[model samples]
Target: MLKIKLSIFFCFLLSFCFAQRELALKYETRLHTYLTFKGSLSPFIKITETDARVYKSNQDKLNDNPEFIIAYDEIKTFEQLVKNAPNDSIEAILKRKGKTKWSKKTKSEIQILYENEDRDASENKPLSGKRILIDPGHIAGNFEMSVIEQKYLRFVKDSVPNLPVDSIHISEGILTFATAQILKKQLEEQGALVWLTRDDNKTSFGITYQKWLSTRKQIVLDSLLECGAMEKTKYNKLKKEDEKTFFWSFFRDHELANRVKVINKHKPDLTIIIHYNVDEKNTDWLRPTDKNFCMAFVPGGMNVDALKGINGKANVLRLLLTDDFPLSEKISDLTVKEFSKQLENQVAKKTDADYLKDNCISSSKQGVFCRNLALCRLVKSPLVYGECLYQDNKNEYLELSKADKTYYGINTNTRVKAVSDAYFNAIMQFYKK
Candidate 1:
């Protein structure tokens, strides 16, 4: 009887060990972890000889639970991972290899998850050590400033031409800055380290429009030279080129490059870009339209064309080996939910218009989308580019024009406050304990 009992106990132990190993292998093979570059794994976690660096959320707690680290020669397509499977299942093969590599190219990837990822170390302040970056879209200034900066103020002149009724010179730079300022205050209140791409309406890149105006293009030209975008030998020749030629190729790219550099320098965990939407059908945007909607953009929708610049290959690798896209999408969904909820609750009136997409709406409930925009593609961190509401919508225009109108307990302009609240709520909810 004693001998029989010992045999049954050994069988149970073996079964439990196999089950734990299967679970570990499944966890390691997931695509989400592979996409995060330089991301940390648990201190004692091990990977198969075919693995690369593992990425962990900076917010995740240290956990060394995985039992079996599946190896692969190189992370290829899903089809490739399964193509060479023998009669024994892929999971079984991984178990049999026991960390041995069939090919010379296979090498184990290592990362150590530190203890600091847990932001909730303190009881009250959840986001104490977290860094958040906010970027307001576009740059606009007075007429001369606009000319100097080569970015015009987006104005919807009243159809009557002289009357400013239903007219708005919606300087996107101004609106976004206002939104960012509001968000910064809220985030700071919540114990977050907040940084804005630009402090005010002026562009963060190069000299201010006012300064440039006084210098008469010399300031900008000097900036281009200082930034290495222009060569000293070709200075005179390139400076004389037509506005369109110089502005599009060299000047625009130089400015964008500066913004990207600043963002990467900060190395913030998340980036939020704020903007107001305008109706595309109404080219003039002269009259208020009945249409209005909110949407959020994440990184994706890239082709080979998008991969042509110096950062192109790097960007491709980031998309493939980083969690930026998934993280962006997750934040975007939260943003959409919060913004839509706030709009519905705070708006004086409700409109029939809601979420709309250029292509087929993938799901009736999804409000976040992938757009291959320069900022979305280039920014290193997870980004949520938000277009809160239509500026040209009849009611929305009036709401945007209002000053100090209270809505949903907020004292700012209804539209601006609503948009700000949406973002605030989203962030709070996303980072809630």
Candidate 2:
């Protein structure tokens, strides 16, 4: 009788263990199919019955060593642990295990999770007590800056027939900022606390491009070299190169990193990155095209190369364990729907853009894509990177250049206000869900 009971207990334990292993495998398969760009097993990531491991390279995997490991049971705790730790603390942990260096933090603060339950029930506002962050796309302050950044829409007189002006000069940065300003106001009226990543004409670093060159350029270059991101020869070449080269290669990414830092530090419930789209076929944006579409990006599409870095691996682990990815996709889907309806632009198909086909994973939602953009991957919150309308379309250029309205001294067209309303409606619908 004792032997029979012992055998039965052992059988039960075996079945439980097998069940856990099956669950882990199923989770990993889902991640590979939905999140990875190629939908294949990454050489840098390994999954066993009990845990997932992230390796620095194939050599590390072969050697049975990993830089980071999180047990299947402890993934939730690990996600919370990362949220509570400061960026520097997290970086220190990653640096000790591998060579991936994160961007320097401007300041360290313990992120406080704002619970919706804490809001007063008596509040009448639709988005009462919600925190939101808006990131306008680029740092082009004027036409000159936009030309330098290559985000300007330029066309000679009579490019499209009935012209509003002799020339069309539409800077994407200006349009995005204006839209954000209007959106911020709308959100504020609904009792949501909103923060913009930068003021008008400024980078995420809170300064103009010229100011960053004067102050922080050399220091950033030195840090990049120390971290092995810039080779010594390349570093030397960059020191002597013109400002345009620096802006293109170094300043742009650095500013984007700063934007991520700012958004994460704010610890918002939702983040919105606003940008006006352009025709990918419209090379140099010197003229215009008729192609117009609306789209939004959520985080995913990581390849093996992206998985090799410590930060990338950590972010992937977070996405796999947390609800951030799903929430982002849901919100983005709603926003894209609203954008198409309001702007009267078609949702982008997989074949609409080359980069979308090459670099992004199509989501189940029609206009929402999973792309590994820096802001999409690192913001640590549910986000929508929205591209509202094609600024380089001949009709769009004329409409966008109208300056029919001014919000907070930012001159924008009536179309921008409509875009803001689209975003506002999306947010309302998202919270209702």
Candidate 3:
């Protein structure tokens, strides 16, 4: 009796101690955190049940509290940013205009028709047929002595640069720039008028958000980061008025204002902004039994198909760009299906994969995905944000980087060609429809 009582007392003390700790972290309005897990740390929390998965598939018992935990090492928490940020990161990132604005000027350079490689003759080739708008994304810094004061005021005195720290690597500008280049080449070949959002060189990287919001700056400090991790110092350099710039900028620059300007100017029938993805639950791709770099996103809008308003944003307009090829590979139209199917054959000839198993197409790391977020939601036009792959994983990065493309890492021609082929086929289908 005495021994049993002492054992029970010991167990109670351990349970009491374990219950004292909880996953306490903060999330602001638009901020998020993703945790990576490999083992059964599931025994810890009851609320995190859905995110937990067991290995070997034969476990009679499940780990309620996972042995380990992971979360995003955010330099700037969204709430801190929202509270003190000068401009909204999202908005500033997708800004339509630059700090140094330009007058509307048209330069008549040698232009080629979609069908023929030859430059357009001095003869008037007024754009007939469908017009398309392609936004490449991002600009580089400038070195003009005249505008130095203006630029310095923004970076030095401005509240936030929207996406601070590493704009060169994971920013929207670089990825969009790549996708736009491939898209432009392909769309032009098919004879569509594609007006890109940015250019290849630094001359058109757009104005830094830092400059735009220099007039009003606010600072945000992260209490969680380690020593010499300048998150706190970087936070204080901004003024107050830049609060809503992030969200507003993305809408205005990427979706509404910038796109509207292009549409009003040229009246494109289609518009697309290519992008990649980041998913924390990426073990399948990261530690793969095979090499498969795959993911997809859907268009956002109301649906007669289902009546769920969980993530509905009215999708604003009937965006037809969502249904554009390279954006969607599900292939609804017969003509496009046939066209893309043939292209799959070409892809198989050059690439090594069991293409037939995936219905002659496979954008999955393993099998088919039911929710293709980048392709489905379109309030205005048929628009979908086609994601290349996850950037955070090493294997997927290696596979996705197999192209002749290189951001910070070198890739082979095959990988680059594969992504190019997918988008190209997607475009061909849109025109066919």
Candidate 4:
């Protein structure tokens, strides 16, 4: 009976030993430590030909690991020493490299950490970091988004006397499209999440200006039904209302309304509205008082003016911009200086034929030169709207008619880089917190 009991006891001990595991660290270099797990860390693990022999002091250098050790660095197998410990637990207490040491909870902490990338993409949102959104003002063409000079313009045979060949005046749609092209490429190069509301800047989007305006008008009607519809009380909670973007007509209110669409869409750090201003012969009645370049915009901060006089304002990000009277004044001041500097450089330094491709403006015999850089208003984010250049001014207008790098300030596709660089730097300063 006694002999049979001893056999059974011995078999049970063997089973427990089989379940044990061992963990070992092999140091091939000061920077490299190889970690391997045996079935269990049962104690002093054996060294094999695959393992190198090292000094006893080296064991001390290894922090006197409580789970497994070389014992004498000559043995082979943990059976030599009687120790039981969880390999994972000891891992929590190991040293990382020469200068760094693992924390007591390293195993738990490491397991808790995960590098996931799908988070933002699944929501169609950008990861939290630097993001830029650009709106190039125009597109290609003669009334088509890519083809300008068609939609907003009508050419009649010289009904008057002798007016040489038929000539074309400026097209708002074309100017918008062109600006968007320049704006898109420039900001993208600087790594921004630039997007355009329309595929191309102009052309009534394949419809007539009247049709386009009609659609835009409808957008305004839709906005009134949205949360921005005028309210007597403070903004109602968004969950209780359907917040939406509005429209911009030739009306200042409408123009500002367009900016709101992009703001809510991009949630960008800054917003810049690109445009070329018309001296509008009405300058007599509507001249901006400022000569710097007819630019206007709002500064950035908590409340969003894009929401306007609505009880429920659109959700403005931490930083918001607007064309309120104050913001318009401040941005106008800075824009004039910035645009003037760029125009002076474009006209004088990069005015060669090829350089003037995107910028076709030139001086006239009348001294009425077309100076580039008109009115642009950045919106939603630290906004600035720059005219970029005057289309009516002979010299400035001529420069803009070319694809020349100098005329566009960079390239035909996206020349707003100079401006983007300035804006980017400003944003970094603005949102440091």
Q: Considering every candidate listed, which one attains the maximal lDDT?
A: 2
Q: For model 4, how does the per-residue alpha-carbon lDDT over 177-210 read when each residue is reduced to its tens digit?
A: 5555555555455444566655443332343334
**TM-scores across all candidates?**
0.63, 0.84, 0.38, 0.38
Q: How well does candidate 1 score on lDDT at residue 256?
A: 70
Report lDDT per candidate: 0.57, 0.80, 0.33, 0.35
Q: Compose the digit string of candidate 1's lDDT tens values, residues 1-433.
A: 9999999999998887777666446435432243222222233234333342222222321353222233332333211222222213444533444434434332221111111133433535766777788987766533444344443324455353543554454445556667787888888777888888775546666566344335646776777789998799777866676654655555556667678777766767788989877766756555666776777777654444543432343344455445666678778888887877887622212222222333212211266655556787778777788888777766666556545664434344766876888898888776776
By TM-score, who's the top model here?
Answer: 2
CA deviation > 4 Å runs, candidate 4: 1-129, 136-168, 201-258, 280-294, 299-335, 345-379, 402-433
Per-model RMSD to reference: 11.7, 5.6, 22.9, 24.2
lDDT per residue for candidate 2 within 53-94, as digits (tens), equals: 777778998997788777776555556546546655666665
Rate residue 346 of model 1 by lDDT. Answer: 23
Q: Could you tally the backbone clashes for each prediction? A: 3, 0, 72, 70
Candidate 3's clash total is 72
| Residue runs of model 2 more than 4 Å from their true location after superposition | 1-26, 39-41, 47-50, 59-66, 91-124, 158-164, 222-232, 406-410
- The regions of model 1 sitting more than 4 angstroms off are 1-123, 141-167, 210-238, 241-250, 306-311, 345-365, 404-412
| TM-score preference between candidates 2 and 3, better one | 2
